[model samples]
Target: MNFKELHNQKTPLLLGNVWDVPSAKTAEKLGFQAIGTSSSAIAALLGYQDGEQMGFSELIYFVKQIVTNTNLPLSVDLESGYSRDPIIIAEHIKELVALGVVGINIEDSIVKDERILLNGEKFASTLIDVINVLSKENIDVFINVRTDTFLLKHSDVIEETKKRIKLYENAGANGIFTPCIENESDIREIVNCTSLPINVMCMPNLPDFNTLSSLGVQRISMGNFLFDTMYSQLERITKDIIDQRSFQSIF
Candidate 1:
């Protein structure tokens, strides 16, 4: 199934975010209709922190590996498109599309000493340029515009999110992703405010698939949770082996 049809499923599309070829293969083997990359996960795997610390060449190579091995549609989490210039961002996206990427998540947050969101109007302008470039190049990539209002805990989050969603939709975003939004009322409000597919990240307080589906969510992404959990388990197993001086932990 195509990425668009995956969103239109009876149940919300669940993307098992993978950071490497092994993880991508595992998710695909487990019957995930599509696979997504977590920026933080990819960064950590490459011995860097999140926020585009991994070089673009390294990232593209990693993505090419997954695309080469997996049959599922892949959506990459390109944090802020790896550049401030919209034309450069579009070029980066074109490269990914050439590597068989079907979708991408581009956020509006700027990562500096402190995380700050870009101005809504300015972000929308950049998004329009990126969309225009993609259209000109004849690349039909799904642009998932992610807003950081809830992630950054902005005071007027609901209002600001709604406003940005409207702007981004007009800017040609195929979907809206609001990570860290757990409130039912807020989710409902955002869902009601836009016709675009809603993509929510998995968080501790976020509702389950059934609850989210009822809230009109179309896509549910695990983000970096799986990678974090896998490493956490690995840490536990290693500590167990060191303390007990036995191979029982492997069993």
Candidate 2:
């Protein structure tokens, strides 16, 4: 399905990011309309670190597996296209489309200091190049370009964020993502600046549900929250069982 069309629907698409085939199948079975692959989840599953630690072949393999397992639309987090070279990244996008992903989330962030680092102009330029390549294919693959301004600890959040949104939109991104914009006004400002759907992360400081829905957010993603939660809960439960103690407290 086209990402923009999906966004135009009355209810925003809620995507659950999965790490493997079983999880994807289970999510589809549970009636989720679409499923996304979390980069961090995939990295943890492969016993490698995130942020390009896994290569293109590995990513395509995983995407192919997920596609084989489920009928739902799959959106992959192809972190920075796993290469800085724009041409290579564009070619990789074509390959990912071949693997049957309906959408992709490419970020403007490089990994450093235990967090995402923004490379706004470079990332946007590569994305524009990738879009041109996809155009030649005559295919409509959703390119949800992610910006890390809100996610990072940086100044000039507004100007920097505006620069990214405008650049990527001009670059032909199907949608935009700002991972952790906690303040309502900040979120509102972003929504106002771009006509493309704004996808936000569901975190602890998430805006009130009613308020967010009123703000014109077209999509919401759980990102790596599900995997982290599962890991944390499993650890707690097993530790309690091993210690002959009952698991207590609701998550």
Which stretches in model 1 have alpha-carbon errors above 4 Å? none
- Runs in model 2 with CA error above 4 Å? 112-118, 245-251
lDDT of 1 by residue, 1-251 (tens): 68877888888999989999899999988999899999899899889888887888888989999999999999998899899899999999999999999999999997787779999999999999999989987999989999999999999999999999999999999999999999889999999999999999989999988999999999999989989999999999999999999989989
Q: State every prediction's TM-score relative to the real structure.
A: 0.98, 0.92
lDDT of each: 0.93, 0.84
lDDT of 2 by residue, 46-144 (tens): 888888888878888999999998988999999888888878888888887887888999888887557566567777777877778778878678889
Q: Which residue pairs collide, candidate 1?
A: none
Prediction 2 global C-alpha lDDT: 0.84
